[model samples]
Target chain A: MNKNFNFCIVDDDDIYQFAIKKTIESLNLTQKIIAFSDGEEALNFMIENLNNDEELPDVILLDINMPIMDGFQFMEEYIQIKPKLGKKITIYMVSSSVDQTDIDRANRISDVSDYIIKPIKPGKIKSIIEKLSMQEN
Target chain B: MKVNTNSEITAILATNNDGIVYQFNTDAETLLGYSSKEIIGLEKAPFFLIEEEFNNFRKDIANRYKENLDSDPYKLLAKYNGYDSREWTIIKKDGSRFVGHSTLTPLKNEHGENTGFLRIIKNITNQKETENELLRKNQVLNAAEKISMMGHWQLDTIADSVKWSSNLFNIFEVDTNQALRFETYFNFVHPEDKAIVSASFDKSIKDKVFYDLLHRIKSTSGKTKTVQLLGEVLTDNAGNVIEIIGTCQDVTQQRMAEIKFKGLLESAPDAMVIVNDSGKIQLVNKQAEKLFGYRSQELINKPVELLIPDKYKHTSHRENFFSMPKTRKMGEEGDDLYGLNKNGIEIPIQISLSPLKTEEGLLVSAAIRDITIQKIAEKKIIEAKNSLEILANKLTIQNTQLADFAQITSHNLRAPVSNLNSLLDFYNIAETEDEKVILFEKFEIVINHLTETLNTLIKALKTKNETVKNIETIMFDDVLIKTKEILSGQILKTGAKITTDFSQSPHIEYNKFYLESIFLNLLSNAIKYKSEERAPEIFIQSVIEEGVQKLMFKDNGLGINLKRHGHKIFGLNKVFHRHPDAKGVGLFMTKTQIESLGGNITVESEVNIGSSFNINFNK
Candidate 1:
């Protein structure tokens, strides 16, 4: 129910992207839900919208395994341009892998807020949105 | 005059003043080896006396008469008032001679006038001969003493005089003419041995007993000599010591030779054990004492077998060694010889034996060396090699398992499950029956694919687990032939030309099923991804690299961009090309099978030129 929040989904799976976007729309969590097939596209959007607070997403769901510029790689590049950004961003690493190595690597990055395993449930998304709203207050 | 008739006594005779034969004696005849009856009147003093003695006597008589004023005119009147005596050599009529002593007295008338001279003579030839013989014996004794480096001495305690033999003076390097006192001989004694020698001499004199002492002395020439003094006190009937006689011998050379022998024994590096022909230990070096942990006195004169190990104790090797009497190296022919120590510890050893010929008999000298450190080093090398092999084996197993887990997570478990989740969400939100039916149909397709991936993963996992137990010697040529048969349809469709050469390394010990699967996967992948611009050409060959068996699969197909996808080239569901049939499972399964058997799979590729997959089989 935080309709004012902006959401971003960076994943190469079209079906997962469609389901996550629909869930966010049904919950009335945000007016804008930006989607990227991979981490490189998501990073380019963030870099292009560095000065635009309204265009920047408040939350990004970053998938770990991708063809080009994976979730960890985006986090490395994002840190370099972070000081130029006009908005504060919260990132969640999303992956279907139950690998402890992937979870530990995502947690070691200070930029990544948490890790979520797929398929992400609707209730989990709602709680994440609620947690971000509380942070706003 | 009458002669003394005792034959052993002096013989006497007399002559008238007129120098005519007048007397003869039995003792005189016997001494002169002549008959007195033939020479009494026919011979006179002139006949029996030597010519020189008679002339000297006449001259002496003339001079004496001239000194006397009142005398008769006779020649015999010279001794009228005097008596004379002289020693004379007289010759008998037989030409034999005797040494004589004669005395002349005056023969006078009633007017006291000189009438005739009376002569007395004695033969003393035997006494002179006995004295000369005694002198010759003394010279011989002196020569023997000088040659033997020995000397004799006498201490006359009553007279307080010390007499040294001629050789004693030579031994002390002093003049033989010089008088020797007890203190003079003591001056030559070494400073350290002086007190002991003096004490021994005093003890001998008091105890009236024999004394033997070994002491050192410094000669007058500044050279030191070892002297052995042996003395016995001479006592009178009252048990009082009167004299002490002793012999001293210079033993410097003998002592020095003993010291040099001892030096050589101590300086040997190895433990030296010197045993006599009877197997008794005659001598041992310092190293031997330390090695056996026994003192020199403890081992000397003891049986040499005490130092031998129990197993070799009963052997007659010691007797055999003496019989042969030759130098030999022990343990050279790989015999495991050991030496026993004082604490009963058996130590590995190498020994060498040599025969020492001495005055006592032949002795065997054995030099023993410890080899514990060498044996330990050899054992450690073997252990380290075995440990290294074990570590390599464990690392290989862990690597294969990790790759398998990655493959399961990325492709087999995630792909279909994620699709099912997406499809279920679509079906739940569909507003029409047609849309729901379409979603269900997609669900069926996703589930079927999930089953297929799961099945493939199970097969790969089974191959890994059973790789060792199912291993057999497989030929690369046979495997290649089978793979070609399986992919013949694809090979013909793509116009792929396949060639093979397994001559270099034809066979390998590996799981047969795994080998066949690997070949099939690689061949089909090559044909499926063949370059469209040219006919696909594939070369399969076996080679040996760095002592490792290798199978090389090369194809002119669309290759991977190693720079971008090198790390995950063999990863499950990791595709580098956009081809419809590029499932990214063939390489993953091939890598799993190779690694599970302790082998490795590596690839080199360009974007489109070619790709070469090499599998190195572990021995």
Candidate 2:
């Protein structure tokens, strides 16, 4: 695993976290798959782990539903921190909801590369990786 | 009343067939003032009766002598004078004329009068005058009897005999031939009044008191009559009470009038407080008692002020109630007047006081009606209006605040977002994955978060009451088609199948925008909550009932445990799914949109089998 490639997975579900972790491990695409259970915990973790040159996640697989801080709330906090990280973090809004609002919101964000409905398979993760590579080129 | 026979008596028997003098009766001679001496040979007789003086007599003779010979003596002499005959009078010795019946009959031999010409101009001046005087007296008596509604009857106490005048017999409906005995007359008294009649007789005869009383009488044919018997003690100085003389009058009409008048007073709706000049209540009906909440006994003899509230206690209207002229209505002036209840509570009442006048003086009567319930209903209406005004002001304030929020969230961020997108597109390429991932992820994450925040703000904005629009019929198929069209890519990607059944034609009565938003949210959630193990299957259907339309969306996805998250399922940002894409905005917006359209959404879910969302809308 490349230490330069650190990634984050924010979701409330253990099963979804396992699936996203397995997909990332099979591809061995990043150094550390930092996992957080909710938007608030993941937001605190991101604030503590900031570094100037450390590469932001090549991709982030974010689950929409959480207890106190859902995906929408996490984005509110995460979007403000993105300018300081100064690193490209490709986000794929992953959810079991094919809801238009989730799909629409993911499409609306300039930072978000695309939207994907879970459970995230290896192929979907590869597709997200391809989108990041395209941005890099 | 035959006084004496005359020396010459000649009878005139005349009819339309023949004018014959059979033998003029002696009374005819006396009536016409003629003897057999001068008129026996003369043609027109020495007596002449003036025509003007005997007009009715001439007509009587004509009527009786037309075809049949009348036995009436007056008619017999009357035929001797014809229509052209003048001066129906008799001549005395000196030729002085006196009104009388004159007869000229053809003298007959033994066959049937008409011997030669027995011209008998009998003067009946004195006799006719006496008959006229008797008739005049009888006419006056009849007139008096009719006017007084009275008739006379005589009873002989000795023979137990009763003799009634014509008017008296008429009252009993009997002929003169029917002997009236003491018992027969007593039998005429009504059975109900027999005792009274008997007592009256005892007082009149044995006790020597004047018998005057009102009682009922039963006639011979069993007809009951109300009558007044006024009699006096007609006795010699011996005081034998020889015969009872009395006048009886039918008084049934008067009695019935009294009964009906009493009934009217008792049944009248408006209270009749017959107060004397002393301000005392004399009569109070049941309605009056109920209106004032006092028993008639309690109200009577009490001053009318008991009913008047404290405000009018010292008023002149109360003091001079008895002195006022008889005015049928009270409160000619419009004023808010009231009455006091038995419980001493003052009830608002429309009071009308009236003066009932009699020969005795003026009386006051009051009509009171309670208006408490009407006053209360009016007060409630005023309160409701005040509440509605407050609600309107609060709604206006909330509406302006919402407009500001929408501008800051959706529009304000749009420009910055657009700039970020453009800057990213213009950037040069990086060779290394580490360098590119670092920068790209930062901008991407920021934009994504901004977009999600904006969408939540929009959800909150839609729930405000000020955004409610005019109601419209929501077509089931149209809304479903539009929402599905918007999420078509998501549907294809999830491998989900969506079908609609509107067999019942559930076109909801709702706002069009709200219905569209509800449809979009429910269908999207069905696809979003799909179980990983299987392809999603969703059915959207509707049902119609009496006045309501129900929409149902069922999905073969991971269902929720209603027992755990039931209360918060429709709440804002209340998401339960573990899926990474579940933003939790869809269900919250769906609930609000449904409610704003005057409808409700309910979910039935089990963790894995399936979930069903039902929406009930007014039609």
Candidate 3:
């Protein structure tokens, strides 16, 4: 319970980003929270903080539909740079699609922790973080 | 010497055993035109005879008596015996000759000693001339029969005998010396034709009618000949058939020619009608009968026009055929030909005519083919092609609609609804009034985005459903100018340089609105995604590729990675570059507008070198 988690939200929907940030802040276990409008912004952030564990996110909530680089495209770029990173990041694909193709594609990526359909409940975020913390322990 | 007989009709003379004339009668003097005053003792029978004939007789007598006979009339005449009479060439004092019957006799004394020979000659020249004429006639008849390949025969029914002429024996390949009988003639008949021959003969005899038949006969040399036999029954005064006289002709060559012609006619796949020079149908094959629905006998001697439909009868090319006959298709002037069958139904037909030279005269053979099924099949093929075109068009439209529906449901509609749900969740959990107000504002933005997406989807669906009717000749340059005007703000901001060359294919037939929209979308995308290293340069040109008019929008801008995103480049809400205005709906909408009007949009690009969007207009 004393452990703090840094969370990242990569999505084009401003309202979803704001809601999820608020939800995570209410948990009291978040030490830092960052938001990117699309996958490219989040990927750039990850490359800039490649060795800085404190700045790097512990969990990434990635949206599938976006104006620019989508979540799947970001995952592709992320996988290529993942070996140089100082920290292991848990990524979850978040979409409102509910389309089997999207779900299947996200699941096929071994780096992706899970696919979560919107709107992601606050308890779901807690469980994801708790699961990650447990694995770390 | 003395002669034994003396008469006015006969001349008597006596010759010593040495052939010297001793006594001469008045009749002999009259016949020879020499008076009895010419001493008989000085004359001899050999003196009046031809030397060659006398010598020949002397040799014949010498051989018979086994003695050397001299040129004496006594030895030549008397050596044969008591009364020998034969034909002789007698010469008179004037050297005129007559064929005479001569008699020679040997006079013997009481001691049976041969004294001399007495001879008598008869005037039989008239009778000999008649006999010679008969012999000459018989030779001429034989020659005529051989030349014509015809032989005559007489069968005596009561006598059970057959008399065949020499030529008849030649025809049968039998020896001329062989005696002919009824059975001999029957044996020459071919085995296959035996029953027919027998029946014909029996019928002719019972009915007392003339018999005529054509049958095959195998000759003695194993050669087969087709013979035409014509027989006439001869009746006696008592009304009984006395004989059957017939003539047999070897007609094998003629028959073979006829059979070959018939075989060719029957083997033809098309109906054949052989017409004489007079335009009459001389013959018809089985196919002709079947096609015209008439018996062959019914068509023979009928005018060829009978089979033609009444509408085409006046256009008969009979005269043209007779004038310059050759092998050619009939009525090749692009007019369809029809034949009227026996049932009065007209059938489409193609005809070819060929000249047929026969012994009787010139003939034309017409070959006819029915094309009803072919015509129907041709019509069906055209109909099928039209239906296939329609089906392909429907499939294309349906595919576009399906893709639009998927895009709307999966991304555009889903994202905003989910954002609204998230905002509602935050609003429900807000602890303060300020937080609730913030959530409500976020809700408003999400709703507006959802509304905008729905409206754009409705417009795209309408474009897909509406049949494009506003087709006009649109200049590529005009569309580009209008698009530049609409995107002038972005063009000015990015310093995009737009150039065009519409000389190759200057204009296209397409919906003006769709053309404008396509131009607007492509030009804005070029300026919006301009490469930071250089000013955006877009070259819009109209060119003809493979006979299709293509409008190319090539840009030197921040191009996409086609290898990675080529599949979904025009997909709804699919954006590759991180740009603020990249909604990903412009290209999708442009593609939809183009494809709905039977055109298509394709993009070729590299990572950063450039991108080219080619629009193929409606053909």
Candidate 4:
């Protein structure tokens, strides 16, 4: 299961955050799951630990809508500092919006590996981790 | 004295003291239309006299000498002796009258007693008729000269004398009795024109050519007249110029009319070109020179078609115009016309033609106007109209997208539902009772969020669908007072200083509830996002902008960075600041309400400085 792999969740809804956390734990995907209520918080954490690969997550599930900053604003700031980061992280856009414009926009970013419409299934989460684990091998 | 009876030029007749005719000369017979045999003895001298004239002469002689000479014709005849004569109307043998100058002499005896009178008669009718014809012709010439305002003069250069006809004296306003010297005519020439006139006259004499010129003359009456002087130099048999004779015509009226016509042409707004019936350019005004880049002399006598472009040369427009001349525009509407200048550059032009009736013949005057600037303006107007249509289409598309966005945002119902789905999946996989109970608690929270979101969406929908029916004139001050009272706690807590000046446009016709709500939302927002370093100083004003009633709310607050979220400032669920009460619903609802009644709301803001929101009311 590659339990050592760390995952991050950026969303403003606490219930969705809690549900995703439980699903990851239930499959024993990782014990090092970190969550932020919005893109700004996750960005601040990533900036604070830019060279600290051990502190940074291997993957991030980003929400499109939030207070303070959204997924697109975070990506704009992240891309500027991406070359300085020690970890090669994968990003997925997780949004409740089925709008083609939002989906197409998130997919156009080279850093965004995939766009997933919520509710994101546990099966989708497991595959994401497994894909990362295969990459590490 | 003895008479020469063979003299053919004179008539000889003799009358005795007793009034007996003895002999009629050969010339007298021809002069009196009679032969000598018919009148030698058949008629006495009394028979030859015109009775009325003889009676008048007899009366005058009796009054003077106390002698009635009626029967004693010889006594009257003796009064006129040799070398003395008197004109007498003589009756001929044919009873036709002949006027004769007759002379008388006494035929005396050796004792010197008067025996009879000898009278000689000479016929003078031909000479008298010639004198009367000359007098009639002279009177006719004077009349002609007076009416035409023209006079003739002869200058005998050799004699240094000048003879002027009567009208010539009138033209110079000089006394007719005044004698004219050769220099007298030159004195009347205007001072400015004297040099030219003298030079022309000298040239004529030196060159042996005639002088014809137009010059001004100031008459003795101080009246200035324009005169056309034409003179010819006459040479004697030896080829010496002996005399100069000419006519001077008063052309003042013609010259004045010409000057006025030229002034009118020069004052026209458009270029004027006058052409004769043969299509030859006769004159061009100053404007034509400026327009075609040609001097007037260069265009004169040139074909008028020289100014028309070569492409238009084949049309025969000028020929058609001359055939039936009238005042009209040159071409059909929308027909592009061009002119070729001296520089060979083509210019867009408009032309109007009018016929000029002149003594020479029919002429056409064309007024040309350069329309290059007008053409350019027309093109720009068309381009502007096209761009405006494009912009209008873009706005329409943007409006459609905005409506779609509103619909999508209201479907925020999906976010909570998706959360519930995730929560349910987690519940099904829960192995422990404690974990299941926690998932249930989380489910309740999700459901509550879902309920709250649904309520908000429904309220937003209601706001969008609400028809405004309670329109009334609501004073801005009244609305502000009520809003302040409602927000009294927050105003006092924050120490917000709200000032207002609604004197310019104090009130608006708007829905009562909407006005109060708008005032409440804006004022609360001002106090809510005020800068912590300073007390909120909010300024509210009402004004009429370009005849549209507007309300402005300005505040010293933590203004939004419009650059970051300007497009979504009034969008649903779009919030900028991290205030605890920031729900992002107030502005969106305010915009929807204002727009429902065909009003518009716009905002200008700077971070940490201030925000000014302007609302334009429809009514």
Fnat per candidate, as a fraction, reads 0.25, 0.05, 0.70, 0.59
Top of the candidates by DockQ? 3
* Model 3 agreement with the true structure over B110-218: per-residue lDDT tens digits: 8776778787887677667778888788788888888888899999999998999889999999998898889898999999999999999999999988679999999
Task: Compute each candidate's TM-score over C-alphas.
Answer: 0.51, 0.33, 0.53, 0.51
Cα lDDT tens digits, model 2, A1-137, are 12336678987655345445655776877677878887777778667755644534555677665565667667777889987785666676766665565578878877666677554556776766665666566
Candidate 3 lDDT over A12-56, as tens digits, reads 777778878888888888999999988878989999999999999
The best-first sequence of candidates by DockQ reads: 3, 4, 1, 2
- Cα lDDT tens digits, model 1, B1-619, are 1223322545555555555555667766665656777656763445667777776676676677664433332353444466778778878667877666667676777987665656666654555666678878888888888788889999998998998888888888998788878899889999999999899888888788967999899999988999888888889999888988989888787778887988888898888999898888999999998899999999999998898887889548887887787999986545888889999999888899999998988888998888788768868987998998898878766776776578576645785697688779778889999978877877877777677777777877786777345778888878877887888888788888989898888888878888888888888888887887988899999988889888889999888778767877787766666567766788888887887777888999987898999888884
Full ranking by lDDT: 3, 4, 1, 2
Q: Please report how far candidate 1 places residue B321 from its true position, in Å.
A: 36
Tell me what TM-score chain B of candidate 1 gets against the true chain B. 0.53
Candidate 3 retains true contacts at a fraction of 0.70
**DockQ agreement of candidate 4 with the native complex:** 0.30
Enumerate the candidates' DockQ scores in order: 0.17, 0.04, 0.37, 0.30
Cα displacement (angstroms), candidate 1, residue B588, comes to 1.9
DockQ of 3: 0.37
Better by TM-score, candidate 4 or 2: 4
Better structure of 1 and 2 per DockQ: 1
Q: Please say which candidate is ahead in DockQ: 3 or 4.
A: 3
Q: Per-residue lDDT for A14-128 in model 4, tens only?
A: 8888888877877776858899987888999999999887889998999987767878888998899899999999999998988787888998999999999988887998899
Worst 10 residues of 1 chain B by lDDT: B1-10
